[model samples]
Target: WDSVIDGNTSMEQFLNIALINAPLEKDYTILGQVLGNLQQAKNYLDLMAPMHASYNSKISKALSQMSLRMSMESYRNRDFQRRWFDAYISLSSHGEALKHIQSLLQSKSHIKGLSIDQDLRWAMIRQLNRYDYGDAQALLAQEKHLDQSDSGEKAAIAAEAIRPQSALKRQWLNTIENNDTMPFSKIRIAMFNLYPAEQKLLSAATAEQRFANLPLMDDKGPVFMRSFAAALIPTQCSAGNINAISDVLDTQTGLSQLARRALLETRQEEQRCVKIKLLLQ
Candidate 1:
């Protein structure tokens, strides 16, 4: 009955209830009573459907930007993306919802206070990647400060995140570090500030150097911490491509085999390199 009343229940719950009870009710009046309950529940749902839509719509707007910023955190994850997908798929016009989140994340409060929680940041990053570089760069700049400040703890965070220099990580970090004309520090500082205290300091150094320089100093080798660091380091040199890459990495669907193939194919294209060059050019 709750399943019939609450739209939020998963399909599994519905099936489990039907399987357990459908056979037990053999009397006609009992069956009719169940049918009446179902009809009444349906009426309630019909009344509340619009309200659900409105609620999710509001959540989607807040989440989209929050999720984008979250994607840049040391804790972006698939579960966060799944929630965002749920909110997004329910909307009739997602554009307003997306921009609302983006605006909040990019607002002064999110950048300065790091109030955009992990789940919300994950949602926004998924949305931010759909736009062009200018938009993505704007998003990264919000949290770049978190990536630059390198205290002892910050260095520890970097060691965990950037230690294993994948070929892609090495390439991207090298490009950003040496790009004197673009003032990588300014750009990355903006990114770091978007993070909470420790993360803001850690991400800066990790984002700056080539992967070769990022080995951990021993004591912080937990699997998830290291995996998170490696994955969060931008794979593309330009903020734009990096943001797009972030979008792909931010969501479960975005990380699908097809998405990986697209990213790999993109990496193979030298034109993308030229486009990155043009950010400074």
Candidate 2:
């Protein structure tokens, strides 16, 4: 909070907490800033990209898109909302929200649909696939055919990978840790989509291993570790999980400064979430 008021927090720190993408070491600082000033909301939303949580946020329309896409991502969650202002706007459940997003692409009785831009269209498709909705593979193929550009190709690759199958997810975890030759672009896609909040089974299955692999991941160097820490580190909002990671941090001497920062930041974020979970309870 002091750092935010003093106006010297790192940009990454601000963006991650704002988008609710992952935890950072000083999340509360930027969040307090966001609470104090309405304009700081976009500062919070800037980290979500390539896999669309809330990246590049500024406009209300952009937030409306994310609200529909991201709401109810976790079926276990109690509320469907996003907060740009002091109060959050209520949102619909997954199926209902998807229907509304789908309507924007085509006419719906009384509503004349507007043609959504390609990136936003892909964001919608990615959400649909994450929820394992209708004919996801076909949707990817059709969109890939429609665009046929480099960005489209990248989106297609990510869209295909985000489908929630245990076997595919296991394969991705291995690939992320071992495939050094994999392009950073694809790496970002895999990391971001591999563990949507809704896919507890996938994230839960490998949560321990994700932590265990930190040393090897850090050895890959900072560039890789930064992206991995930001996106691949699964969000486990439990005191036990936080303590487990804390134990590793307390004893693990092999982790680099960057890797250590990642763990600590994740710890702080998890702590904040734990408080919120208790309140919700």
Candidate 3:
């Protein structure tokens, strides 16, 4: 109580004690006091001057470190809630993580100024395919269009801006909460796994065929296929052809991974069969 009111104690020490003893061993009603102390400390540090120029640099660095520590501590607390949603999905065979993210997106308050990281956005979208979050879906589609239209880093950033959250997201959440009678989990897993590869393959094949038919057909077929290949081929693969396929395989849902592994196994078996045939011959 003395430390809370005195403003001499570090925020870390106060928060640590509150975490351990708050509403448990003690009434723990000092949150506002701690925040006020922290704000005051920040203001003081901002205005304080060190004796030497070198010391001023050191002081600024230390203040930055302290601010980073506080931000990390806050993130840790937020992380606990995210982990609960992740576990709910894992155990219940529904997409709780997706729904939670969708809810965040739907509420401008939650997503405001929250620069969703790229990998996080991808994971959220991938999960959305498993469930429903209609707003998220529309945003993602717009994001995809923007990505397709832009080039270079701007394109990548545009792609990362939209994420998956669909109406199906809440349905999956409900299924998980209600113990998964719907069993759409398996179906969701399969679709997410299969679609990326199929989409890539379809685009590649279409472009190639279009290019081939351009020479054979009359009505500006040559121009059409040439432009089609130019415009469409680039987005189909992130890297080269092989890397794109591998990326899709690597990022697939669990069921997709299983299918990919099985396909690889079968291909290996076929190679072995060919070698055996050659040896016998």
Candidate 4:
């Protein structure tokens, strides 16, 4: 494998070596280790388009056999299950991947008091969204333990609610407003796009106004600046607040290059719109 990665050995030669040294017995541990190594190799090969599909068959076979041998207890671990699911999804279509995930979800017993892995849960949510939004909402409704305090879970739930077919937009807005731990600027921006009037109403209800009283350029950290810049630029453009947009463009301390570019584009577009309006008049 090292020789293959280092370009000393061809992939075909590496495959031949792997096949020749294959153990006769069905050892799950060894299979798991090999699967990990193959996954790494696949990542490297992904950069070369011609060689991308070469490892698909081997990876799929390993995942199938590993799934069969591994117990439900083993699958309860997030890292273990994520590796398997990610590999499976990479090789299979969305429908096939969802079918396999649903089978695993159905087979596991919550009576063991083990929590469902968050990655598995999020994967199901995402796949279900692709497959059926109604079914995804139903599943979300059934999940009683979704903690709003956990930023990841909150983000996932927010993502689900923002989907076009979701009817829980208002619920998600409330959840985002109440989440005091993480910055809500990103979520607010999403909500603003989808339900501007409702987002404005929610923003008014909250004491901390959206993107209005952000920390000064020197005071804020990178994360805060990024989130604020991401949220502010879009909102200002949409609201036709060109002055606010220019202010963001003038500030040099915290905004990322991407943010600056977006603001510049937005300002130019706004000016173009104004010129078009004047010409019409």
Candidate 2 local lDDT, 1-281, one digit each (tens): 33443445543344345445421213545543443432333322221221223323233343344443433342233221122111112111145545664554333511112234687567767766776766566777889899998789778867767888899888988888888687878877888778765465578789889888888888888988999998777666667778978887987789999989988888887775454333322
* Off by more than 4 A, model 2: 1-93, 106-113
The window of 10 residues in a row where model 2 has the poorest summed lDDT is 84-93
lDDT of 3: 0.35
Error of 2 at 126 (Å): 0.6
Model 3 agreement with the true structure over 98-188: per-residue lDDT tens digits: 4555664445325222345544444545445433344545656655564453232332332222222233333332232233343333323
Which candidate achieves the best TM-score against the true structure? Answer: 2
Native-referenced Cα lDDT, model 1: 0.37
Give the poorly placed runs of model 4, Cα more than 4 Å off: 11-35, 44-58, 71-97, 106-119, 123-147, 151-281
State which candidate has the highest lDDT.
Answer: 2
- Which regions of candidate 1 fall more than 4 Å away from where they truly are? 1-94, 108-115, 118-126, 146-281
| Candidate 2 pairs with clashing backbones | 1-29, 18-44, 48-55
lDDT of 4 by residue, 109-146 (tens): 33132344665565555445434433566665554245
TM-score of each: 0.22, 0.66, 0.25, 0.37
Full ranking by lDDT? 2, 4, 1, 3
User: Per-residue lDDT of 1-281 in model 1, one digit per residue for the tens?
Assistant: 55433334542344346435633554545644543443332222222233334543443344343433433341344443333233332221256554555665566233322345644453354334323212644454444445454432332232222222245333444443344464433324322322221122333445444223223211223332233233333333234545554454454342334334444454333233333233212
